[model samples]
Target: MHETNVGQPESNDDSDGIDQAWLQRRTAAAPLILGVVAIVTSVLMLGMLFGALGMRAGIDLWRAGNRRWSVILGVALSFVGVVVSVMCAVLWGSVLASVLLSRDVLRETERWRGQRVAAVECSMLSADGVRVSSLHPAPPMDRLVIVFVSSGIDACGQALQDLAAVAPDHPTCSVLLVDRDNSAATTRAFALLHGADFPVLASETLLPEPLGSVAALPTLVVLNRDGVVECAVVGAHPRSELHTILSGAQPVVATEPKETQGP
Candidate 1:
């Protein structure tokens, strides 16, 4: 009769411990589950509203050292969603407006190129106070390739090195580098790093009409012997394309060896 068998204290403790473990597991999985939901929502919304949030969550998860590949894939998907959303907005808003906007952009680009070409035709004072036409003095070659560079830009340095590498192969083409900042120390360092043979010019006021007003670095300008800007490229060009530009502008010089007769 009397007292019922006392429940085992150890069993109660074990049950309590199992419950705590289950709770901890659920708590740990909550953030991951929320992240997945956010990513799915972002995709459904075309990334217009929740795309950035989802991307941030993915990045945070990666930083937290959890599911690296999943986070990367999620980040990529979020980026695509954002881009798609933007494209959709642009396309759906007004097709005519988009076309007109693109046309205006192209026109502006062409206008800038024209200004640069015109600037190349103008005269500029060199570092030595010598009045030089275009960016640099016209080289004693059939064609001239002027590479605009800056002190801190990596692309400019790469373009300079590319030109230097191809300089020997193209005898008729001369490669000249113009430092936009006019930093003598940087110019010297660049020359030393790349090669001493590549000529470097330091002029602050060079191309005052175009380059002086704007900060467009790493431009490649190809000119004919007549000092006319044949092709004015606004960014770094491929080595093959650079070669093509030079080769296309190569002047056909006809020379006949004079015959000498000795008596």
Candidate 2:
């Protein structure tokens, strides 16, 4: 048998070198383009100011002159300069605003992508005040779970109503009600109204930090079994979006990553 190298490419060094060179060139060019823009904006503003000054001087000179042509020229130049200066200032302001907005958008994107949260260890307390943490380090699966945290009477009552309305059809689906109040009255009400099926967790802690800010009075977080946040909403949602999220089809609004910027 002839000696041969199996699955060997002839040469990648040349192509690799080309790719590196191209990347370097592109990186270098980006700053140069920004610098050029700044310089151009500055030059245009200066030009506009000078034009206005020349126009004013011409007007003065023409007024002092015995001839009509000198006066006309000076007045025309002054008008031209003023108009150009206004346009330049407006354009510069607009460009500056856009640059700032883009930077903000990019920073937000990087913040979300860079942030990683550890998987959650879920615990639940029944209306009877029983604690259940039996499953520590629960296997991170792909199923969807909604956490409804309530503080006041209205929220707790509403959650019970909603869960009762939604849970039977979603047996695999878990609804964790984190009640901070934990009052006997609240506990009794919870058990009587909504405690028959899904698990309920009570907490003295006010809120879940990792979820960040919420918009509406009632908040809903749809998390994957892995504990990574899949979708989140602050207020009530349309029946359609809610159903889709429960079905693992649509992502919650807050989970949609914000716009990003490029260097």
The numbered model that scores best in TM-score is: 1
- Predicted candidate 2 versus true structure: per-residue lDDT over 137-194, tens digit per residue: 2444344444454545565456555555665665555665544446434554554564
Per-model TM-score versus the true fold: 0.49, 0.41
Q: How close is each model in CA RMSD to the real structure?
A: 15.7, 25.1
lDDT of 1 at 141: 75
| Top model number, lDDT | 1
Cα lDDT, model 1, residue 10? 41
- Model 1 misplacement above 4 A: 1-35, 40-139, 208-215, 249-263
| Cα deviation of 26, candidate 2, in Å | 81
After superposition, the stretches of candidate 2 with alpha carbons farther than 4 Å from their true spots are: 1-116, 120-122, 127-129, 134-144, 151-156, 181-188, 191-197, 205-208, 212-216, 251-263
Q: How far is candidate 2 from the true structure (C-alpha RMSD, Å)?
A: 25.1
